[model samples]
Target: MKPIFPAIRLRDKGNWLAGRDGIVMAFFIHRDHSEVGPAIWRSIQAYLRAIPPGSLNWYTSADGDMVPLDDEGWEHNRHVVIERIGGGSRTVELRESPSEAGSYQVEYYGRRLDSPFHDAPATTLSFTFPTEYLVEHGAVRLRSLALELARELPLNFGYASFALVSTQGSWASADWDITEALLARYAGLDAPRAMRLSSDLGTRALAPAWLTFLGQPLLGQLGGIDALRDALPFPEVSLLPMDGDRVLVTLDEWPDPIDTRTKPIPPQYRALAQRMEPFLFQYEGEALLPYQQDMNRWIRRFL
Candidate 1:
């Protein structure tokens, strides 16, 4: 069956990795997880669930021991490599190690199983893989479909921000940043647009609104909104006034008529909303601080 959406299977040997490890196995489609549309999410979910259990292997280091793993456990511990193609015919490999600087390598793959891209093999892809594995695997590559899947999922094991970022050091704000970047790249807007959409502020009102908005009744007294807003990607505050606070934003103007906003609410969104609705009462009318519970709720909502 010509799969609905493309997906890549990630496996590890020697070090355990997977969803639980803050590594995403692959980016599949779901209503709430992506703006990519339901059809795409269904295709991706099918591709992943249909992965014939045990088709992939996982490795992990436990107590100075490298052990093989089963599907469930492996999926929880392995780090997934999100593939991306950047410049024409080029693939960029990203792996990071806190012990050292990240290894950024770009190369071309013509005809090989490890080679994932198929567009004349001349396109550039940017992707994230665990340095712990890459150091052992020694320079891995992916295909075009794999890259696209990675970009779509845009998160590694629910840990690292998958798009335009190399590490998960900022896992706290990964989701928001990823969403903003995706919107900016596809919709043509920067941080300002993200803020406006989430905060309901206008261009001229952005400044004063920002001051008061940041001090929202809920988020102000706790001094949490500033941190949250700072975590987002926005145009420089200094540049906002000169530009009339005209932040860049993208609207789909493609002539191809691909309706990204196709209707029919998704189950994932419903499920997520349900999951988050309960949390609103957890704090009992207090400002929604950025606690793990708050983060979890937002993550549920965003995904």
Candidate 2:
């Protein structure tokens, strides 16, 4: 099928300017209950090499070396540090997986910035495709090539909440949990205290209302006040698949657009809708850079 969006243009030759919310194949370190230490790391590296423009390069290492660690050296080791090639500062730290009977840990060391424009730190973002491209020329390869083409386009600024991430399960599971937790715990709280909930306890008590308005049901909707709250329109957030992809590339959380003509929408409700606009975009199999950049700008404004 023909691509809906034109190939992205890159002003910065060295770095790829990915549109916000676009999915890209990424290297992830996983720990499974199987033989060999750093085996998963090695597998992912090998996988990275097989892809076109498969330079097997590191963003951090000056030498641009690309090699996987073997079991003999890493299996028993407590930690494995994977740094980006080509002198990039990003890195990931992998530790043994933990269990009730055992213990293991992994950390995402995102980009270590010398300085950033905002108070927010540098971040590492990841997405995944299938293993078919490395093995056979197919749709996955097409997507990768399209991404590379997009990379060749101009550079633009974007912001993310974190630099490094270490999760206990699949990439999707970890990413969803972390993003939600960060949004609720950090950005949401840091937002200006509106006049509606000025009192200390009022703020605490009313906080859940905002969350509920956002489509996160704190208390189960059985009946009574909770059920009434549930009936209210709150913005909803969900991860949904794009086309036939195994993973859901898009994460949507928006205020419910349903007008409350019977009951006028509150001022804060209006603020939330205005606040969240930058983050929402319609994707119909097109280059996502513009939409992603827009969303990032909104996130930055709210942050």
lDDT of each: 0.24, 0.26
Number of clashing pairs per prediction, in order: 42, 33
Write one digit per residue (lDDT tens) for candidate 2, span 210-237: 1221111111111223333333344332
Residues 1-303 of candidate 1 have per-residue lDDT tens digits of: 110111111222322221111112222111121122332333333333423344223232333233444554333332221122222111111222322212221111112212233311111112233323322332112222233343333111111121122222222233544433343332111112111111111111111111111112222222343333343333322111111111211111110111124433223323323322322212223555566344333333322
Q: List ranges where model 1 is wrong by over 4 Å.
A: 1-95, 99-265, 268-285, 290-297, 300-303
The number of the candidate with the highest TM-score is 2
Please list the Cα RMSD from the true structure of every candidate, rounded to 1 decimal place. 20.8, 17.8
Best by lDDT: 2
Q: Which segments of model 2 are wrong by more than 4 Å?
A: 1-3, 12-50, 62-303
lDDT of 1: 0.24
